[model samples]
Target: MFGLKESEIATLITAVSVEGGGDLDRVSIENRFARATWSGLAEPGDRLAGRAIQQLGAARALSAVVEHWNTERFAAELSADGDPVAGDDMRQAIDRWMPRLKSDTALIALRQAARFGARLLIPDDELWPERLNDLDWHAPSALWVRGTDAALAGIVDGIALVGARAATGYGEHITMEASAGLVDRGYTIVSGAAYGIDGMAHRAALASHGLTVAFLAGGVDRFYPSGHDSLLTRIVENGAVISELPCGSPPTKWRFLQRNRLIAAASLATIVLEAGWRSGSLNTAGHAAALGRPLGAVPGPVTSAASAGCHRLIRDYDAVCVTNPDQMAELAPLVEREIDVSEIDSELRISSATPGSEVSAENVDTVGARSPETTRLIDALSARSARTADDIAARSGLAITAVRAHLGLLELDGRVTETGRGWKRVAVAKPETSRVFRSPSTDSE
Candidate 1:
């Protein structure tokens, strides 16, 4: 159907499905091939395409698009089947998807990806991160993965560490410590494979003999940030380098922003090591917070401009001020069971024996250790005037339920008080404390 012989199509499907460890029937093969076509045909996070595929199966959706049905006809077909897309939205989607429609593009992409030893991972695949399904319509149609299946499995328990590409020496050092510590505690590290903090995180995890996955904005075949070529190569050897795009696709600004969603969704938590006021890492943090995943940020010197983004996250976004591996580890749920008794004892010895192994709770409370929702509620509150829950919801962009929950936490923290009118931010002195450092090395950084 895509200008390839039936035998060739079967071979391609087999290659992609082999790693998934599934027996594919003829129907399954065609569906898998259709999804590959959709991957190349649509941009990442294309809601129109996602909706169509969800309503009609991938194979049927591709047929509907390829048949050149007019907007009115397509809309009527969808509406008859109880789909919500119609009129201008349908026409716009058809117009956008038409130009990329090619009979042989999917076949070519599949062959190219296979040549580079990449596997096509669909939602049904065993190694697929089920967590990504949480993204709903924004989830990828298919993933181009390069590396061990075992490495891909690590993603379910992974934590994303990301920050500014132009990170300072301080940022690199903290990321190094955090990455290594997490690795020692048996958690996989995930990052964007960008320069600076991202690069250091991967390198440290690798040095610690830990599995680390790198999510790329472009195709898995071509690593972005050309300077990280060797590093990415090593990652593919021990960890996986993955992308939602097909081979030969290039990274763009929009894709980078969209890519952050995958890193956040795939991991159990996301940590910002260092960032400026407008660092792209904040976008990652936003996605994590919105997804209800735990988010963390490392505190930098109050004077260092590089740490401003991290500080902003703590002050405004309710990010936990994670200073050491232990604090960072706390962000992940079910992590306590993952640690070995021996490892816990070893960590305690190191924390007690080492001069600066632990950062006190007071040190970590510079921005207040409330949940992100609490921080948002506090930000929405007025110091002098009481505001109702509905008023707080409108201002904080939180749902009424979330606002109430956060208000309860804030009230318990003594940071807010309820009045006849509503709630008011309580004026209180934040205690003074020293910055927490994990060790002498981190202190120097």
Candidate 2:
């Protein structure tokens, strides 16, 4: 649309438009265009784009989004020939190259984006959200947007609701009621499209006839967690599903974590309905707080494991405590909003190197490098003090023998010195090499 015959050039424009100004920096523009281009062609624009991206990194690419791209900047930096051969010659050379992809593949992406009930929204477009600029290098190239464009028209009124995929019944119920209530109050709901809470929220919003948006961790063309394909189809017709990645990218764990930040940043407020101490939803909450968005958590029953994270946030992090939709909707803004934290003291305070940081199952020694089952057993025991093998097995969903084997390893590692009574996880000063063996979960805690 911007006079560049190459689709990558057009996509580059979409990426650049997210920023506020219209200036184009040929170098940076070329870099972003190269990343978008992704073809085998050896065009000059592609070569230049690659060099810029290599020099700037994804972070810089994100910055260029909101920054003006200046053609004059290109003119000032040209080589001595005055012909601008290095720069101008490259631009001319790119014109000689064919558009990178097969027409069929390109058409498919466009058609799928449309059929998915999504419109390709570029940065310069009227409907683009200015707040997305907050993401910096993390910002999207272009958003495949669905649902009513009118829903996005009102910027000040959207809310993001997110939580676990393995949601408990209580979590799903809370999501449904809160999403419905939020919609009733004229607030658009935003979430991912995973099972459990995310799916529940989107479905509830649809049921209530409220506007909702789903942000995916992959391409707009290929929906990950394929079970949600039909569910997503409904959303495209009734709400929106968006992605910052190019069309057809697969959803990886890293992408999923990255996607949460968008959910938090896109809305005025973010409410974490239910999460475990380790649920990925907390990543969204962290993003919300960092961005200075209003953050709230539902008060779950104290005994419920799913609510443990929520309780921790309200008690420790000072997240606004919400009971129902009304409380969530009317959360009083704290002048100095403290972060809500569900991080458990036991989880945080325990040390892998400490002498007591060990558990003794019947056969397994689980102190150091082992399977996930072993890790799960250790975490369960450490979090709750001493427990029988059966209890540990039930909580961790591991075979009894596997749990026992991990316990044996922990004892041998000396990371978990055994007690006649049972085993416990503790911390101790350790050698530098030993530090590498520590669990990441322990470090985060």
Name the candidate that leads on lDDT: 1
Q: Predict model 1's lDDT versus the native.
A: 0.76
lDDT of 2: 0.57
Query: Can you write out model 1's per-residue Cα lDDT over 1-445, one digit (the tens) per residue?
Result: 5445767877887886635525777788888888888887877787767777776778888888888888887777667656556588777677556656777778888888878888888887788898888888788888989988778988877989999887899999999999999999889999999988999999999999999999997788878777899999999999999999888766654566678889989987789999876677777877776666777889999998789978987776557788999888877744442563223322212122334332221222323344544544665677788889877764443556667877897789788999999999897654422121000111111
Per-model TM values vs. the true structure? 0.74, 0.56
Which residue window of length 10 is worst by lDDT in model 1? 436-445
- Candidate 2 segments exceeding 4 Å error: 1-118, 154-156, 332-445
Candidate 2: Cα lDDT at 342: 24
